[model samples]
Target: MSQSPHHKSFTARLRAHKIFGGIKPAVYKADALRSRVMPAPLPGNLVLPLLQHQGQPAMAVVEVGQAVLKYQVLAMGNGPLSVPVHAPTSGVITAIADSAVPGFGAQVQRCIHLQADGLDTAAELQPCLDYRALSHLQLLALIDAAGICGLGGAGFPTAEKLRVSIEQGVELLIINAAECEPYISADESLIRERADRVVSGAEILQSVCLAKRCVIAIEKDKADAIEALSTALQDSSIELLVLNSKFPTGGERQIIQAVTGFEVPRGLLPVDAGILVQNAGTAYAVHNAIVEGKPCISRITTLTGSPLQTPKNFEALIGTPVSFLFEMCGIDKSQHTGTIMGGSLMGIELDSDEVPLIKTTNCLLAKSTGEFPDPAPEQACIRCGYCADVCPARLLPQQLYAFSRSEDLDQLEEHGLADCIECGACAYVCPSHIPLVQYYRASKQAIAERDRQFQTSKQWQSRFQFHQYRLKKETTKALDKKLPGAEKTTANEPAQPFSRDQARDEIAAAVRRVAARHSNRTAPSSAKDKAKDKDRH
Candidate 1:
């Protein structure tokens, strides 16, 4: 946590930047941040899903009933986008089967069920004390081995992002500490408690990406976190910028715009703008991976809402069930209505509490029966333009809603539905109480499915076309071999049709002539030659 004497403090004045069309929602995170991150009790059962990150799901390495230690690899990364899944604690693999996991929306994915033995045995770790001495690839390999990914968003592999950033020549690396979502302060809490670790992780990321400059962008409301980061970054080159606490400010594009005043072009990534943004918690995990030699098996999650007696953040394992957290937090079953993962605006309501936590899970809001009731009935759009005015991505929510209702994906794309952050800002400001974000979400899903089908169809079509081309090529080659003296024939003496019977007769005549010559030489010619030799003697 100490700063080097040679390092200079960043003297730039802290300035806040504005983003277009953002709403200021009630940040119900005070109670959650009241306590530090407490370690949750190890559950008897953990449901580790294979597809924890955003890529090809990890393939199971440990079979059923296999004993595994903490930090041991349970599943191996299947592709470049994937990160390995590690054992949260020493336990025996009970089963590997399809199970329900949070953020997967109703679909069951393959999960590794583990029965905790309570001993918490650990495997050997390869900690890098001096990451500066190692090459970027070495550091990234360590991160990959640690299974670190973006803990803030969709759980994109951190190694992959860093690799891409390095390839794109990143100029600025932005640490996203803006926990703008209401009732979710996991990032803020992390930065407040372990700002030094976050700073160190940012430095490692900067080193790996070879970024020219690095900055930590946080909300102005996170005063404690900012103070801690300022203290931690006293002798570092990394800059700290405080942004106004607004809804969706923590979004990648929004944070980018707020920090650098650059909007990511549609259909392009932030890296296209020479910028790389990572979540604050992801930075912390990087620090742990490089310095502490710990894999990303757990994360700090915010558990808050009216149903909990004592709401706070917990460093819960990845596969810990939400029901366990609810029980640990002393949930009032009589008043508990349901659990929503992430913030109220963008979170998905869980059908059952048995769903295990995944990498992207940041918040678990247990709503009371009356709290967070269903939205009002859908009303006709009055064209008041309120939804458009509050959109963070500057997308036409009204148009998107209409297109979504009619299943007009082309129009939706034309209006920039892909650019929509789904922050629920338009829905928050909607006059008709129409769930505009819901419509946009549905449209985005439809577009994704359509694109997937299109890509699959294109692949099949390409294969078919190649197959036809190959057949034509082979047929032409066979004909060339069959055609005799094809190139020798002139225009006036065009090649005649092939005749198998004529070729057979010609071959037979040639064989008969050879036999007649051989008979003449061996019979009467032999006697004449002998008489001539005797006369000469």
Candidate 2:
């Protein structure tokens, strides 16, 4: 039976649980949502980074000076955790060399530099007109070939996530349309412009995962988006879950809990909890891949900040440089203090404007000196418990901060440091201006490094034990050959490991045999000498 929008909305609200602990920050997304997503002009050059996704970097297939059409596979996914890289426009591969990774400071990774030609030629697409007729595996193959990933800033491969969802069996599929960040409105814009496509993509995902039910979770502030999605889903069974707009409400853990009234336990994923959450942008990409027969060559990114003359969303190609976007927006260079990728809480400040926008960039926020002034000097924690109150993961930020400062990894782990989402809620609420999230992030890295070192130590220990065993076995074999009357053991009899006392006994027995043999020879020589003397007489 098809559910009405009102019934589904009410049901979702009744079953929803309040997110553990979250803050409601001012949402600075009005300017970006003022206009529709504008198609960005093809740049003269594009720098496609290989390591845009989570896992291993993609391996380049095309060489320098090769002419490639749009949507051509330039680099293939190297490992299970990665997705392939596709050409955004028809261009010649000019160089494959190290380039600065966006958002990551001073880090360099391999990139495919392309010189775009005047013509934007595209390769032939193979769209599936009827996805229902195909098997689940076949649909997955198509999605993987298209190089789709979680466009929600995580960049997790979509096919890999769905494969796991299928294996584990998903009950609730949540399409996270909650753009709860302060300045980013990319997902909202995508849904507003292409809600039908997003719905179709959701249906396709439902079929793939065999989900029992699916829902699109959106915030109440996004009335236009909700209406668009509601109209598109009128004939569909997918539900619309309208939630209160709160900072970090769109977080995977928070959203899962909000929709299903179940919190994904610490140290486990949403799939472990029988829930699969995908970004609204990712679903749109899947629709393009399955129905339009298109590859993930471009995405909608929000370019908004106080330094720009006009802030708007752009449907940008994957490899366009940040400088070009700034130029298109008529951003004032003198007023621009820094460019941050993503939102204020979770976004990273890019060190250079030359950084190429990759698959995970949802927003590029150009800040002026007055807009995001330097944080006040960190003050001592007053222990007012405000940080703990705002932590959505229900973690005690005060304790975590102390443990982090002291490098008490065991204590941090016991207190649920791994579950900390680093949403910056604690820092935002801290009265002393302490950077609680920074401490938590550093502690997480320290824990990871410690774990890696411990694993290496275990490997060395295992190798040493094996080496010692080999030496002992060789020594035992040598003793067996040297010792006499040591009952020859048959192949079926396993060699008995010798104790220190047993080894001593074997050495003593060998000594006695040698002594006895010498005495017998001497006695025989004496007898021969006596017999010779008697014969002479």
TM-score of each: 0.86, 0.87
- Clash pairs of candidate 2? none
Show model 2 residue runs off by greater than 4 Å: 1-16, 103-106, 481-537
Residue lDDT tens for model 2, 281-311: 9998999999999999999999999999889
Root-mean-square deviation (CA) per prediction: 6.2, 8.1
Structure candidate 1, residue pairs in collision = none
Top candidate when judged by TM-score against the true structure: 2
Q: How far is candidate 2 from the true structure (C-alpha RMSD, Å)?
A: 8.1
- Report the lDDT tens digits of candidate 1 across residue range 361-440: 99999998687776789899998999888998888888888889999999888888888888998989988999887787
- Which residue runs of candidate 1 sit more than 4 Å off their true CA positions? 1-14, 104-106, 462-537
- Candidate 1 backbone overlaps, count: 0
Report the CA-based lDDT of candidate 1 relative to the real structure: 0.87
